[model samples]
Target: MISIRLNGTEEQFPDGSTLAEVVQHITSATQGIAVAVDAQVIRRTEWASTALRPGAQVDVLTAVQGG
Candidate 1:
């Protein structure tokens, strides 16, 4: 198990989990989502290959349309 900071909150996941897995757990929407790890933005194509390390700072943001 490993602990990571998710959007300012501490969260846990199994060891060796990828960023894609965490993103899936956070939302079902496939578009308008942005993810950053340790303040670095990660591309969608790289999410599956990006591994989450313990005590990592992860931030997830979703875009919203408003008038």
Candidate 2:
């Protein structure tokens, strides 16, 4: 298993996991969300090709509606 920091919390997953897997594991709704790895923004189209490394810092932000 590999360790990664997700939204400021340490989490573990099997090796060779992609960004898409993590995103799916975190939430079911994929819309209105942004993902970053090691402080770099990852485009939605590249999520499936992006792989996570041990100790990687992942940040996921969701859009909110406000006036």
Candidate 3:
């Protein structure tokens, strides 16, 4: 198992889980969501290739319609 900090909370995931998997596991929504690792925004195209590391900070953000 691998440990990661997701959105200020600590969570565990299977080893070799990609960013896309993490995002998919957390939320079911497909669009208007963004992910960042260690304060860097990762493009959608890179999610599949990006792998989570131990102690890495991961943040998931959802967009709101009303301002």
- Candidate closest to the true structure, highest lDDT: 2
Give lDDT tens digits, candidate 2, residues 38-62: 9999999999999999999999899
Better of 1 and 2 by TM-score: 2
lDDT agreement of model 1 with the native: 0.93
* Best TM-score among the predictions, by candidate number: 2
How much is the lDDT of residue 40 in candidate 1?
A: 98
Model 3, range 10-57, lDDT digits (tens) per residue? 999999999999999889986888999999999988999999998889
- Model 3 clash tally, residue pairs: 0
- Give the C-alpha miss distance for residue 43 in model 1, angstroms: 0.3
Cα deviation of 53 in candidate 2 (Å)?
0.8
TM-score of each: 0.91, 0.92, 0.90
lDDT of 3: 0.91
After superposition, candidate 3 runs with Cα above 4 Å error:
65-67
Please give the lDDT score at residue 16 for candidate 2: 99
Residue ranges of candidate 2 with Cα displaced over 4 Å: 65-67
Best-to-worst TM-score order: 2, 1, 3
